[model samples]
Target: MQGNKIFIEERLNDGPGKMRCRINFRFYMLLLSAVYFTMLYIFHGNLQSETQKPDRNKLSMGVEMQNAFLKIQPPIDIKRKVLASHQEFVEITASRLHVQQVFTTSGAKRNDIEVENSIISTKRTSQMIQKTSECFLPAVTPNRTFQTIEPTFYVYSAYLDRRYNDRFVRIMALLSLNKGNRQLKVSCSFRNSSGSIVETTANFYELCENHGRMYGGFILSCPIPNSDVCHVNVSLQIKPVHRNYVVPETVQVRLPVTQLGWQEFPDQTSGQHENHGQHATFDMPYNFSICVPPLFGDIDVMRFVEFLELNRILGFQHFIFYVSTIKNPDMYKILDHYKKMGIVTIIEWALPSNIRSGQIWYNGQLSAHNDCLYRAMSLTQYLAIIDLDEFIVPHNGEITLTNLIPKLFDDKVCGLSFNSAFYDKKFSKSTSTSRLLTARHTGRSAIFSKVRTKVLIKPSKIFEVGIHHISKPAAEDFKVDKVDTSVAYLHHYRDCVPNYGMKCKDFVEDNTLLNTTSQLEDNISSVLKLVFKERKKQE
Candidate 1:
């Protein structure tokens, strides 16, 4: 009994020690779990912090900022070198861009001179500025501070190409000056993968056609320092060099810098070398079409919109424009807006290096027109070659062009001709006029007294198209039909703005053209109102 009691005491002491050991083990495990969770939290935080670091790449400048940047210091001289005939050319991926100037007149005019030549104008003091509300004109005073109007620029089209040769770096730019002839100093830069720049600078000569309209084309055939050049930026800085009397302020026009390896192709016609192997397969061929060649001068936006809408209403499915340049930002925006809907196709119309300067018309317009014709032959059944200022309106009850085309078609007829009728701006007179949003014909009668002839042809039938007619005339191949005057006609609103001592006195008042008989008038107005309404709603 004594031995049994001693054993029980020893067992009780061992039990307390065992409980203590177990408690100590549990405390150690809990401490380890806390440390592991703390380590995990720290590691996760570090990873997140690393990911949240700001990017170190160079940022692109906004339009206004870039325009402002042009006014800085000694003009930036971007230089380039062309490849020799024998040297092996380096092929790098580059972006193609179409840069155009945005020309706008400031309300402040220089001395409010009405004459074409500023020097020849007679200065009259204390003139009463007549304000009228016929076209919502704003009230103005004869004495207002006038600042020199500087041109602004923007890139309209861009595309990526893998097979880019340094020899083919042709930069096409459209410049419109309010005053005297301006010269451009062009600078080009190529950026490699490592962010190093290789630059070249040169003076770009103004290329003009017989019509005296001028534009710029620079052939940059320079050797790029890096074989792996990924991007190219061209800056065409305008310094009114010719106008020695008036010091033109610096304005840097930024063309698009190509980003390498990014896959983006512009919506170009199939004939262009750039369109090779990347032609988008279409479900159905375009039926009726319109092709407008590259525009050089400042575009009237309101008129452009009306032109597109009226044609669309007339049932032209596809519209193509060989766009060299446009000065209006609103016009560019509207073109892009329509492009998204597949209603318009914009192609950059730069003269290829092989073509001589004389081969083009009105600053490479003829070549562009011919190219457009060739491009449309395979894609469209019929193409109406016209300008933004010209419209084909049906005189018959038939509203849509699609409806009227079949009635005029015959076994031998390859094209159709419409008598061109020109309208004077005085017929649609407006005192308070803003061309960007308001139609030129808002308050005018539908009177068009003068008439000339224009042509619309089957793309397959014609080999070449001229400014006024379709040609490459072969007795067996070419057959054109003239539409009856009572059926249809072409409406051309040519330049009617009078200069000093010149007046637009030829137009007469008539309502037969656009009032009750013409379907184009109602269709155009309704569509424009609807478009403006939708745009306002979105705004």
Candidate 2:
């Protein structure tokens, strides 16, 4: 009985110990499962965070939105197909809205209706931001004015003139000067790229100073203080020494700056120790360019075509026409067609309303001519400043002006003064009944003189240009050489004018213009056809 009781107690104690051991084992297993799951969750979170991290080189939201829209946007045909099905269109629009919301919004809790409304609001806000951005941003102010009578000067353009050893910025303008205004003090305020402004006294030079005119072209020269600044905005403050004149006390005008000389050879360094003759080293884009003054009134299209074609045949590569007012649509269309073909450039040259009444000649011809002079300065080797009616006809068997110029003039000759040979419109020969004006008017005046003559000038060698002649040469040695009548002459076609002491009744039969008549006709026909064809297509 004693042995049975001892065994039973030992069995009870051993049962309790085994139950405790089983509980401890289950607790350890639970702890291990918790730790493993926690580690797995942390690892998954780290991977997701790495995947969702923003790129360092990511574009702006607007650019990204544009790119994204372009990528998913359906083509025209696909859009048509989608539009055909109302249900599909609605679904696609919804999908697009959803995508846009994803791009534009952050994570926020909202119902379907709220989300749609939010997307619409966000899109509108983005559009407003984009539209206002242009209005707020700072930009270079263009040289223009609407003021009629306050300012006494009209600033045209600013140029970085590196022609001389002392590099300076030349500002071209038109000053209204009276007899009372003897002396003028000019100052230039230059604004650099970093918004820094510098002011200096400028040397003012009137182009037609000795002419005793009311209004004339003037140039203001100021030394460039900062060579590092590539671009600058120049403003001129002109104060007349004698305030007794009609001119204002102080007139301020701002102009857009253009760098000259460097455009011809961009790689070539300026301020080099080179002579005026070394300008030939630079390669010009055009060998020859014709600068026509501001064309106003009704211009005959046939005559205009003939002039362009004849000049083109005479090896004039480019034509720059400053248009003041062209009433004829056909004339504009012809100019546009030529502009498209890269043969012509039409500049809108509407003069200030105040100056138009008492303007110098045909809406500021002097200013326009000088503008063309500077514009074509770096572009072409030679520029012929002439009117639409005049033609520089080479009579020495050298058909092209390109060929004739070199043979006739030397390097020192900067300009060729062609004596005028009047072709009176009323004196048309009975035998000449051709459609072309040049062919129809074979009778030219016997008198050929330098009075009211035209010039073909080397743009680089001439500085300030005039209607009939070059007012200023770039260098002292560079001169205007008068071409003999046998070599070349300006064929001035106009109505009978006996005011200049020349009788239009006495006309010599000179068919010099008819040399290129055949080629001119063909070119005119081809150009007109293409112009009309293009017009039809546009219509």
Candidate 3:
């Protein structure tokens, strides 16, 4: 009985110890499972981070590149400050016009001078004073010519454009002062028939934005309330933008204002003006005209003839040539002959003594084009600003621009842009019996999109002109249409392709220029013979 009692006590003690062991074992297993799940989560997170590392690096690189670009080409409004006088005008015209803070790439601001109920007057002491609207009309006195200042900017031409209801004078000029970086305040002094001077501030705009050239083109828009102005003088007030820069003396240019007729005429019977009505009953002198860029250097006489004759056959009635330098005397005789025939108008494009011939964008071709645009605005229905070697040829056996233009342009369209197909001189083949250069060059490089393209725009509908496109259109509804290559393309004849490391190998046969080769050759030969014969007589 004593042995049995000792055995039961031992069994009860061993049962409690076995339960404690089981509980300890379960706690260890739970801790190990948690550690294993945490390791797996950490591994997955590391893999995801590695996959996204390249995107983060690229984003950082993009930010660095943007910083570098900002350093190289600064924003247009860098360090821009508004003049007190200009600021006052900005406040007055704020509701009427969108006052833009104009500045150049060189960190100079061009303040838009908009005046309301104010006029600029000069007293006997030769001091400019601001007067109220009551003093807008000065006493009718003898017209006095202001002393001409030294030439700072080359003024090409000025015109009084009354095409829109708002009458403004447009001055086309080359911004040749201080490498196109100098900031100068511009104003216009208008002299009416009564010999009174009315001075007003002008708005300036650069046509080309840092085209990688030292010089640039500008258009000075001077708004005049009254259109009865005989002469307008441009006055420049020089101000130094940089600390080390020296300010030049104030310069003045006197320009004769060529007045243009209004787009719509008042009804004679009712004496009421109509908006967007039929055009004035005046006859347009030319249906289609071409504005050739500043002509310089050694020009191939044969190629010149071909350019004019082919375009003439394609319904170009007039050609305006801005002559910088003609190396060949025969070219002069040809231009003179065409001038006498009333088919060509030559303007002397002499640059300033300090400016080089080809330094500015193709010898200030943008200025010349803008000048030609205004000059031809009143005369031609369509104006094409193209280089000497480029030609707009129609496809599908279309000959004249008369038919093609109607199909391409409507009332809503104002500008037509054409892509270029370069006719490399090396790949030219003598395919035609007429032996014309355009006819011989049948193989052209593949058509490129927006590469060295040219435009044909309605001169009246264009507000600002550029080398390859229109900078501003006259109306918001008037948009540019990119003509399909299947219809037409620009025939750009050059010695080499423009792209770097591009072999002039891939070429397609385009003989659309040969459509009018027979007539072109006859006209060119006749012109050449006449010009040479006349040259012999002069010699």
- Which predicted model would earn the best lDDT? 2
Worst 10 residues of 1 by lDDT: 93-102
The true-versus-predicted C-alpha distance at residue 20 of model 1, in Å, is 40
TM-score of each: 0.42, 0.68, 0.67
- What is the per-residue lDDT of model 3 for residues 1-539, given as tens digits with 9 covering 90 to 100? 36645654465477658666555556656777889899999999897665544342344535555455446552222211212343344234332222111211012211133111111100110111122111111111111121334444666566676655567888776665354445677789876556677788878788864376656777888888744654577877776667777776666767655444335321212223235555642435456779898798888888888888778667676788888878987788778666544456677777766666456767777777887787766556688889888888787567777678867877667789998877876676655555677877778875454756789987777788788887887666678999888788788888656574344667777767666766666666666766687678978
Worst 10 residues of 3 by lDDT: 116-125
Stretches of candidate 2 off by over 4 Å are: 1-150, 179-184, 191-196, 209-213, 226-231, 234-254, 262-282, 499-501
Say which candidate scores most in TM-score: 2
Whole-model Cα lDDT of every candidate shown, in order: 0.47, 0.64, 0.63
Clashing pairs in 3: none
Off by over 4 Å in 1: 1-284, 352-360, 428-452, 473-475, 495-539
Error of 1 at 454 (Å): 2.2
**How many angstroms is residue 279 displaced in model 2 relative to the true structure, after the best TM-score fit?**
5.2
Candidate 1: lDDT over CA atoms? Answer: 0.47
